[model samples]
Target: MSIKSFAARIFASHIRNKIDKWASNPHNTQQKVFEELINKAKDTRFGKDHEFSEIKSHSEFVKKVPVRDYEELKDYVDMMVEGQEDILWPGKPLYYAKTSGTTSGAKYIPLTKDSMPTHINAARNAILCYIADSGNSKFVDGKMIFLQGSPELDEKNGVKLGRLSGIVAHYVPGYLQKNRMPSWETNCIEDWEDKVDAIVDETLKEDMSVISGIPSWVQMYFERLIDKTGKKVGEIFPNFNLFIYGGVNYEPYRTKFESLIGRKVDSIELYPASEGFFAFQDRQDANGMLLQLDSGMFYEFIKVEDFYSENPERLILKEVEVGVNYVMIISTTAGLWAYNLGDTVQFTSTKPYRLIVSGRIKHFISAFGEHVIAKEVEQAMKEAVAESGAEISEFTVAPQINPKGEELPYHEWYIEFEQEPEDLDKFAELIDRSLQKQNSYYLDLIEGHILQRLKITKVPRNGFQDYMKSIGKLGGQNKLPRLSNDRKIADKLNEII
Candidate 1:
């Protein structure tokens, strides 16, 4: 088993080296590069079957496979959970990385030997980009922390299997690994619950110079650090120079997190998952880390106009329209072909392919008939904060259907700050005005007052992190979703406000 795994890794490395060469070419046309990748995807294999064997060509594959969400993949997930290998891959998958999906509840994303390299390489590239950001290649020579998911894999009957962390830990390069932490933190082998505690405890013991995880989880650790030392974030871990996070938007929570840590550390955005690591923030400021699309997977983007224009066709990456939201599809070395990841992104520029995440299409707030998309909310919040001239440490907006009081639903914002605003009412009004100005649809809805009210609740300093910890989702994989459009969360926020 070890020998076969090693061989698979070698083949992957060789492919990656070739890709690096192609990507480095200054004049290589994207069309030529994509066609080459499509050819490669057609030939890569896992055990006996070719990955995406069902599709003969990239064009055919993209045309035939309708974009799928987690629900559409439930039966495939059931197969992995049942340890069936015939349909998906040759043998049992390495481990299932538990991930949360909208409506589907808890999902076990399949991870196999072929897929693991994407995570490693993507992480390495992220660090490398950070190094470029810092202008120091040796930036990661000091201690580093990875806030990730629980290692335990669930068995067919719901029994907890061995730790997924342990299984993948050893694959990490030795020179950069931390010594104080147990092998499990890096190994991907230990049980999930144990691994979380172990990672947290170990991080507490060391002079961690760099930390990486979801912002929500990182905030939870800050709260824990405060309780442990009675020291504010800036005082407790003032030495940390680099703070990298992904899995969720960091803008809303940035102010509160930076305040606790007492320093504005440099940050990098990582786009990764059990299936594959696709992109990272590039080292250069202007160049969004050119997505390492040529890595283990081929990427495609669907135009938002086409997506919403009654036409159901998908758009290829080369054909994406700027400023429109599109779902990302990937065909990876792992056993997936033309897989829709459900993440929505909009292109900032087409030349180098810079983009900004626009939030999940499946999870927007449409309550009370207000088309308050994530981008609309983000822009409104940014504009409001800018207009109010009052600092916002952190904030989240939920659409609420007020029970008993009025038939019209409203928007409520939960804001946390280091200090209180002089006039809370004006601050809320500013936010409302900004939303009205930015989105025409929202403005139309507001004119009719479809959403009658906007309410703000000031949270105790450091309260948001406490909420994240309460959920048992600190670091690595679990993230505090920016917009929890669920009725339950909205109802709870309404009660608190």
Candidate 2:
């Protein structure tokens, strides 16, 4: 075997042993992890305020700390941002991860020394697990390109501020740093368009083995590479075999990315947010990601169906049922206690628990009583793509409420197409039909004449890109919401189109 493959095999074996031990008894591992986290933070202000010293069990911890969202915890985070130590974690955060603020205004999430390792380690474990399961380690021998945000961190109140990708880029291990592409100077470029161009220029002649990034930005890089070299991605990087991605569902972009690369590649999905690295695709054959139970984050679940209720029931790992959507609540080492991350997920396995992200709590449309979610919308789009043989680059859905009897209420879709179908009307019809099949309320609205058929507006080429550029949110972990209850995104799309 090659030297790279030999090294990968050894590392994979070590990671697999730890995973096997952790998965052997998830119940015990989870309890131990929670206890350890609580004890470590007990002396901190948040822990003491919640009576963490007196709390001995999971039930006691739950009773003391109530579930909270980002807005609710903003005040405490503000204190930390002002250079206060031991306000949340044992010390002030090393840096703050600034989220894209697509749903709300930009959020400043804390990243402490204690919590940073979880991000790094979980990412490493994801690769190790993939290596162990797939026995494909040649990718590790060559350069791996990670399309990330600018690495230049801005200082705020004596704390560093930057995107998660940028922050993580700084902490990439010294050994792998040598093999990682896109030089540090290039990564620090603030302008995404300029940064992508620099990346394409630098890595074009390198031996690329793996690529990792959000699908949209990576697709842009692929397009630019093809434009520059006049060759398919696989032909340009003959050794490239793995595509690691997250930030959004991959199903919608699968066909388009495959077409760009000119071949199929193995993929690994990760569930990492600014708050914590929650899970990663561990098994090659499994559909869901394995929860990072050993990560320094304690997890809880509140059923999505019960979320808006006056009092929602919070369930622990043992209590969560497979296939039920739940709002994840986490108490992390970074000082967030019972914090709601806003993302919705459903468990797919109980033992050695695994889950799939369903949607965002704030990113749903319920106008006209036709409650539609991200999953349903994505599924419909996928079906439409299959039936119409069209390729979509990006899309967003919003309710187009009638303006005082001017027109019937309906859903409006703004789509950027890579390859438009032969018949646009048929493509729209297929999407509408697929959505109806997924959502009974949507189907009822159509059948009962409560709403008109969905309207598909073909966005001009590069319309979404221009919109994002105008708003200064062009790339790196920023994504347009698929479904919205309001016309905030739609109104903006209207202007760009």
Candidate 3:
């Protein structure tokens, strides 16, 4: 074996040992993590304001600091952005990971010295865990191509700001840097199309062993590679074996990605958000990602069913049950206290705490009291694609509410297809059927004549891309909301189409 591969195997084995030790008694360690984070930030401005010193127990912490979304914490975040030191965390943050926002134009999340390492370490451990579980280390011998955002960062009030992927890319370890592709200059291209073209030019001939990115963007890269080389991904990168992805569900895109690669590769799902690196797929046999309990964050879960209620129960790790959707809340080393990250997740295992992301709290359609989530929509789409033998590139759903006359309101789907199904109506029927089967509320609504059947709109190729680009959110962790309550996104999509 090569020296790099040998070294990586050794590191993987070491990490596996540590992970096994950590997982042996997760409950105690998780509790300790909460205490440690609280103590660590007790002296910060936010901590003092929230009376963190007086907070000793989880219940007390919860009572002291109410769960807040980004907008609620914007005042403090804005203070930090305006060169205020010790506003959230001790001292100042190293950088700000800018994410797309709904009301606000951008969300500048703090990334501290402590939190940054957690992100890097969690990602490293994900690969290490896979290596330990599968006993495969050949992927480390060659190059790794991370299809990420622009590494170029802009400075604001002595704080650097960029996409999380780009920020992480800038901090890639020196040893791994030797095997990483797409030079910093290439990665700095602001326009995604231009950046992707540069990436294709730079990494097409390299000995690629692993590639990591959101599944959507990765598929785009694969399509571009195929068009350029007239060869499948496996031919272009013979040693390619690992695909690490997160951000969106891989189910709908799996068939198309497999076809592009020409074979199945080891895939790892992660739950890294702009807020923090939360979970990673650890075991090959597991259905959900193992929560990063030992990471520098304290986690809380509020049941999604009760989330809208006036008095929702906030459950700690020990209180969470398997098979319930929960809105994740966190108190982090980055000075976010009882912060709601907005994503919803369902726990598949509680002994070791493994979870699958259900959907976003905001990205759901409940216009007619038929609550349909991203997971359900994705599952329905997968069923439709399988039954229709069609290939979907991307899709988004929105409610068509309050028609001018007596027309019944319905769900509208904007779909971009790689391979359109021969029978469009049949495809639409299959999707509608799948949704009706999955969601009882939807079925009830249809039966009661409160809602019409879903409408399908086949979008022009790259319609989503064009719309995102038009809004300056084309790439880097910006995803189209799968389900929206209103026609805001739908109307925009219609305009694009």
Candidate 4:
């Protein structure tokens, strides 16, 4: 092995040992984190308001603090934005990660000194673990590209504000500064397409060993690279073997990516948000990302089925069961207490607490009492694509509550296909059947004739891209929902269908 690879392996060994030590006792680790968080923030304004000093246990904490999403948490965040120290965390946040919100135009999630390391370290550790497991770290010697928002900052009350990915850009370890790519100027280009072209120009001839980005944006870059050089991505960057991605499921895009790259490359899935870096894939053979129980965050889970129930029970890491859909809640070093993250997760392993982000709590279709989630639709599409030998670029599902004639209401899927199925109607049935198998409610709706199987609307090539562009959200962590209860997405898609 090369010197760099040997050193990496050594470091990986240390990191893995550290992870295993804490991960072996997840609940104890989480309890320590919870205690630390409570201790650190007990004197803060939020802590004082919530009677944190009196709270001694999870049950007491739960009673003192109610689970809150961005909207509910905004009052405290607003005070923090207006330069109030001790409003959330102990002092002013080091930075504010500005993310888009549905009702609120933008949400500024605090990134404090204590919480920031978890974000950067989780990403770093993911790679380290991969190297340790695979015994390959040659990529560490070559160039790496992280397709992300520009490292530009807008200040609000002395707090640096930018997209989470952009803020992360500024925090790329000094060791990686030389290996990172696109050049700072290229990354700063406001237009995503222009930035991508510049990226292609800069890295076309250089050695690129690692590439990380949201799948959709990275797909665009890959397409541009192929078009420019008339070669597959694998050919262009022969050393590129590792893809680190988050923000969306990669399975549905796997086939299209393989075709684009002309080979399969290993990938790491991350579960990160502006709030915190929660989990990451630990082993190549693992079914899910290992939840970061040892990270400076404490987790609580509400069963998805019970989430809407009055006073839904919140279970801690030790109380959680595998394979159940849960709405994850957290009290973090970032000072987000009992924060409802909005994303749903399913625990796949409880021994070390690993989970997959299942779907968003709000992004579900239950128009006819059949609560179909994003995971179900994404998995169904994966199954359909595998079975039908078809390729999809992007797709979304929405309930068609009312039909023009006397036709039954059904789920409408807007699909952009790279390779169309031989029988489109049959392909739709395949996806429907997959969904039925996964969700019993959906099955009952179909079997009872309350809804038709499903209708496939083949969108024109690049339809989703066009839709995103029209809305001025072409890239940079922007992803359309996998499914929705309302016809908002479906109605707009019908214009081009």
**CA lDDT, every prediction?**
0.61, 0.88, 0.89, 0.91
What are the per-residue Cα lDDT tens digits for candidate 3 across 381-495? 9999898889888999988887669889989899998899999988988999999999999999999999989989889988888888988877767777788888877788878
Q: Which residue segments of model 4 deviate by more than 4 Å?
A: none
Give the Å error, residue 193, model 2: 0.5
**Candidate 1 colliding pairs, count:** 22
Against the correct fold, how does model 1 do in TM-score? 0.79
lDDT of predicted model 3: 0.89
The better-scoring model by TM-score among 1 and 2 is: 2
Q: Candidates sorted by TM-score, descending order?
A: 4, 3, 2, 1
Give the poorly placed runs of model 2, Cα more than 4 Å off: 100-106, 156-158, 403-406
User: Which regions in candidate 3 have their CA more than 4 angstroms from the true location?
Assistant: 403-407
**TM agreement with the true structure for every prediction:** 0.79, 0.96, 0.96, 0.99
Ten-residue stretch with the least lDDT total in model 3: 473-482
Q: Check candidate 2 and list the clashing pairs.
A: none
lDDT of 2 by residue, 1-497 (tens): 77867987898999899988987788888888889888888888787788889989878877888888988888788788778778778978888999855345778999988899999999999999999998888787799999888888899988899988998988898778889989999988888999999999999999999999989889899999999989999999999999999889999999999899999999999999999999999998998999998888788999887898987888888899988878999988788899999999988898779999989998898988887889889999999999888999999899988645667788999899999999988898998999899889999999998888888888987788898898888988887777899998888888988
Which clashing pairs does model 3 show?
A: none
Candidate 4: global Cα-lDDT? 0.91
